[model samples]
Target: MKRIILIGRAECGKTTLTQALRGHKLQYHKTQAVNRHDVVIDTPGEYAENRELARALILYSYEADVIALMLSATEDYSLFSPNIAAGATRPVIGIVTQIDQENARPDRAEAWLRLAGCKMVFHVSAFTGDGIEELLTYLDASSAADENV
Candidate 1:
């Protein structure tokens, strides 16, 4: 499996999505530091929330096969720049979490991610398992493609 580095603001469900992708039961765990699992690198939301720590994410991106930019559908605004992922050497994808939230607006999240230069965006709800399979499928395909190169 290709290793994926997930970056996002606090409470964007990066940890939950990592667990889901690993076939583990969903659990709430605060990531205080970079947590490297078998195929996922979960980072603290503060890394994205604070501009000073943003450099850490760039360094971490170099260690993964893919860079995943996550955003919550309920977010009122995007914390990322329009070209946030433009400097990444690896393929960057977007994931919109909290798709099942009552105030969820996946379209808005997708738009924001697109502006951030994410060519492929996935809208998922970890709680309901919605769109998880497709995300996994994409990851599998990405890994395969990486192996070929």
Candidate 2:
């Protein structure tokens, strides 16, 4: 089992994405870090929270083959890795949520990721079930490729 840490802006469906992956509602907490038995952990994006979470995630990413970065369509700054398609050591993918919003543009987001240097970026809407499966497909394939490599 791999450990996937979900980090993104508040109200960016981090909880929803975890639930969808686990097929149940995700439990939130104050002191918890990694969820057990293949459970994905969720954390608040507070500066202190992120500073702490980032360390744990960096370590976890060392063991896991992938780091799924969540990005908010409604949140302009809800991104990581300073503009890249994939990150070092592990394959990274951009999860675009809130696609139902009026300003959520996948094309623009794709361009941003591409410009940022991300080799692969996928879009998803946790509410409408729009791009979840597609993202899953990409993640699975990328992870498989990563494993094979």
Candidate 3:
């Protein structure tokens, strides 16, 4: 059992992604809070209260081998990154969520990352189960690839 923490902005599907891994929504609560960091961020992404949550996530990353920093593909990816990293310097994966919507601009998101010089970006849709497996595989490989944790 890996101590992996999924950190992301509000409504970025952090809970939803955990559900997928749990096999279903009902199975989500069956697992211990080990998989989640117990967030208390206020409504709206990156609220002032999120700083506390981000700090917890920061501490959790010390114990976490992999931190999935999720972002909205509809917006710029660079905004929520590095900050969520919280000095872990660990193997962090960038997840761009909510790409299944008709207004979702995955290409624009990818292009924006490229323009910002970020090559380690993964585009995924939690609703349609797209690229979710790849994110998990990346998380698993990150654990084996690094011994720092």
Per-structure clash totals for the candidates: 0, 7, 0
Give Cα-based local distance difference scores for all models.
0.90, 0.59, 0.55
The digit string of per-residue lDDT tens for model 3 on 51-92 reads: 664455555567665555556676644455334334456655
lDDT of 2: 0.59
Candidate 2 residues 26-118, lDDT tens each? 454343435433646565555213665556666655655555566667666535545543344766655666678898776766665555555
Error of 1 at 131 (Å): 1.0
The prediction achieving the highest TM-score against the true structure is 1
User: Residue 1 error for model 3, in Å?
Assistant: 6.2
**Residue 100, candidate 1: how far off, in angstroms?**
0.6
Select the stronger candidate by TM-score from 1 and 3. Answer: 1
Clashes of 2: 7
Off by over 4 Å in 3: 26-49, 76-78, 81-86, 110-119, 142-149
Please rank every candidate by TM-score, starting with the best.
Answer: 1, 2, 3
Question: Per-residue lDDT of 1-149 in model 1, one digit per residue for the tens?
Answer: 67889999989999999998888999899999999999899999999999899889999988998899999999999998998777778889999999999999999999999999898899998889999998888777744554322
What is the full ranking by lDDT, best candidate first?
1, 2, 3
